[model samples]
Target: MRDQEPAPVERATRRLSTKETAELLGVKPETVYAYVSRGQLSSRRGQGGRGSTFDAAEVEALARRNRRESTPGSSPDELSVRTRITLIDEDRYYFRGVDATQLAARHTYEEVAEWLWTGTLRPGARFTAPKESLAAARRAVSALPEHSSPVDRLRVAAVAAATADPLRYDLSEQSVLGAARALIPTLATAPPLLRATYTDGAPIARRLWGRLSHKEPDEASLRVLDMALALLVDHDLAASTLAVRVASSARAHTYAAVSAGLGVLEGPLHGAASGLAHRMLVDVLDRGSAGLVVADELRAGRRVPGLGHRLYKGEDPRAQALFAALEELPAAHAALAAARDVVATTARHTDLHANVDLALAVLTTSHGMPAEAGETIFAVARTAGWIAHALEEYGERPLRMRPTGHYVGVRPPQPLPTQTGRE
Candidate 1:
């Protein structure tokens, strides 16, 4: 005997029309057809062939994947990437199951990076560079113009270091970690290693401070910088992290993957946000009123730069943590007041809240660093994150992030013999 057919209601519950599927996926009708074409969601013609109907379960799965893929602009809503390094919740960030805020407050950037690279936060984790790589990095930086930005110098140094390292082709876990360890210090422009007895062997943050500033290092400021770097070590899969992963998925070396990440970070909406925030802060400082500057910017149809985040509904935890650190220093008073004023004014006028970019701007300028220093900090700190993501992708199936384009161009070429003469 033939099997019984399911009831109409049951079938209706399991199926969705094209329009309904488009709404469910937050895409257009064309996108629904493309999904069907790509086999992401199965579809069949309706009775009498009027419209397309999609499997409801498949549409729902695609919706979930789209949501997961939507992050930080550069990552399009197509591929769902999985990572165990970091998780961004509504109000908190976790790095390898540990609260990033807690880790930021107490740990060095090296320790946080080690934790992200491996699941364990071993106290013995160290970041040191070989002498040959250091020389290559110095040569690369020396070759750049005097006006080159920190990130620019770092990028050149990265390429040079990669070229110099004979073992850079190794994709082994330990070998990759070793290259990462060697690469970061070079990128930071650390002074040449003399001897174990002569060097302070300070943490990454302190060494970075020395590289970026001419002023003598303050212990308190260095501590805050360490916290900032720790907090920024990883965040889910940011656009740059996704870029790094995409490169690593193709079996690219750690330096190559990081170079790809830096390319993404150079975008205005990504790593350059800190510098933009600094400009906004300077505007407030020059105008002598944070509220006035913010209101004027909004009136001019511009957003108060760095005042809000898409992911954080209230305040970004990184911002709050860095703000708390700022509050500890007397020198940060003006920057803190500007930040609070912008926050309060924006909150009164709109739903936005202060984010890490503003906090970073405040931290840098308040300490007498240039406005662009914030971008430098972000780039340096995020290098660790990109490397961690590259490592994660190296373990996955190679080239798995290659996404198929949904063709939306004109139809295929066809014979038009008679019409062609008229045209």
Candidate 2:
């Protein structure tokens, strides 16, 4: 017989480097590692066992899964909104293309707010509440029950302030800007002050400090609070931000748009996380260990608050920035230690990281503020973001945010049930 054909040689599967895998998945290399740690994908040592490599086919399959999960029914281009204000990519975020943490480090909250609103950093920018609006907001907030949450008080204040402004219906950029400037300060000063030393014309953070705590604030503490506000000024299209945009798409005035956002913020998953974190920290401090507290939270089927965020695969950038600031304050040492302990204790079970809520809890607990103080700070700080979203939405087509309903319930034409006659 003619020379037997050589048996076909088996070929090894193709492998991809980490950089290639990340590019294929449309994420950063860190995110690729995060996926591996989470068990969503698998990796093997490359030739000579030098670097991890992913199966090429496996990476493509994961890319498909991610696309399916992130955009379920609609295409990304259709469901997404174009925005020039904030961009969250990888684990870091930006405000107007500038690093948000850097902005918070270099500028006051007012200056950052001005930059977000107009794309220009106005040094020494100041926002003053209109006296009439402030008085009306305070009156409305005072009428609520004593047990009303800070967000409740804020919603009432927004409505009251709206009534005081006769030109709220005017959607002109200048008019909206005017309303935004007046409304933010009005909201900041509307809550009942805990101390009698409240001073007008101070920065928003300074004014807010008197409302949240009675203790005298040191300059370092004040710096932390100011930076917190600046850092929290906006987070791109959060649940509350979406509400504000939807309301604005319907032509709601600035105050109403903000009120719509506040309504959504009161949910436990959104704005109340810091308060839960505050309570958890208190529990950890009292029990003298994070292990027991973490176990109890898991046993109760509740997620450990302030631990992880949906948008971040690594430590929250906001938390990182705030933690660095918190390190300088002597008073924050105990709470800061507790937060770290909590993170370490939880890491054994999950790959989660500390989020902004944990940092806020450290601040509030260390400064003698009540649990609800974080919610107040969030509501006040996010109002600026709500206004900015409202301004952008105003320029879009009216009712552009309205989504078509997908009826998954019983199909439309069921026979009407005849009412039974009572004997």
Candidate 3:
């Protein structure tokens, strides 16, 4: 009755610019361009040829494809060990089937150290010199420009070592493992930059990791360091690992791969927390009162830097292990001890646990090592895991992470202006 068949209401699918398309899809404009480059999207030019536009339907389909591709496996809650590393969402570190915290507490760091570098690296084995190829590595590091940060120093050293030894091209398992361990300490104490005014770097204290035996460093401190490394070693598909894997995908050598990982660590969000943790401890020590320190941090609207973890629901086992370990340190800072007590008592939850950061701060405070040492300590320890992971990635069939986009552009072309409508 109301206009019989009802007048057909024509609907025109709208077009969007690249920027608008990116916003709609929650991605960067460049990513959209990448999708276009890969032929995953389709676009057409306006009749006047101002700009190309894409069909909204095609764009939606591409977005759907991306969602399907990114969905996790069937058992999302279950953990999967990918490559050499095993991830339980965001809270564990494993080195070649070994639990990091267990090794850190039960065995010397050296044993854990050797295991990462070489899957076969284990404790109670006689140390063997591998031709001092790493010796040349020392000379390579000292030659970088003086302005390099610890990260750059590590990168430059890798490049230098890469140049000095022709043997790096060999990706044999034996060789990769050896490189992982040896380069660790080297990266920690690289040769001073050739051009800068800097103090001499520490020699790779070959026995330091060993000194963390149940005998010295107050078993408590070593425990803290161990837990810290275990927790810090890796995270699931973090920006850093993503960077490392990206490089690995190109079949870049291990050094380049590790170097790529370091690049991500150089960022403030990733590697700077160790520094922040160290400073927080220094503040507490300087204030000379742990209670005052916690109160001060709380008043300032700053949560204690090392007290909680993102994944552990406020009860980090590594932190628990470290707290137990801290009880055994030689002259551990009284303030840190007090702060730990304060945090346990006053925080929103009595359950707010100390994380690897606080644990590492305790270690550095007790050891009297340099303040920026945790980041380096972590970098060295994790190198083994990264290599192991890299090897695993290298062995897998390449997925070739190609970028794609949703095609969104201007309007369809308009006919050229006819003279007077063909008067």
Scored by TM-score, the top model is: 2
Q: Against the unseen true structure, what C-alpha lDDT does each candidate score?
A: 0.79, 0.89, 0.60
Q: If both were scored by TM-score, which would come out higher, candidate 1 or candidate 2?
A: 2
Tens digits of per-residue lDDT, candidate 2, 1-423, equal 799999999998899999998788765576677678757789999889898999999888877664441255677545566677999999999999999999999999999988888888888888887889999999899999999999989999999999999999988778999999999888888778887545777888888898999899988999999999999999998999999998998989999999999999999999989999999999999999999999999999999999988899999999999999999999999999999999999998799999999999999999999999999999999998888888877754456676667778998689999899989
TM-score list, all predictions: 0.77, 0.82, 0.64
lDDT of prediction 2: 0.89
Q: Tell me the lDDT of model 1 at 411.
A: 85
What is the Å distance of residue 237 in model 2 from its true position?
0.8
Q: What is the per-residue lDDT of model 3 for residues 305-409, given as tens digits with 9 covering 90 to 100?
A: 776766777556666666666666556657357547556555655567777667666776666655566666667656656676676555432444334555688
RMSD (Cα, Å) of candidate 1? 12.2
Clashes of each: 0, 0, 9
lDDT of 1 by residue, 1-423 (tens): 989987766444577988888777765576576556546678788889999787788888777765554345555655667677888887888997889999888888888888888777768465778888878888877877777766687788889899889999988778899999988877765332222211335577766776655666578888898888888877777898888988987889999999898888888788888887888787887877787887788799977788777778889999999999989888888988887777887777588888899999888878777766777778878989998888766654455677768899878796665644554
Relative to the true structure, candidate 3 reaches a TM of 0.64
lDDT of model 3 at position 282: 78
Candidate 2 — which residues are off by over 4 angstroms? Answer: 1-78
Best by lDDT: 2
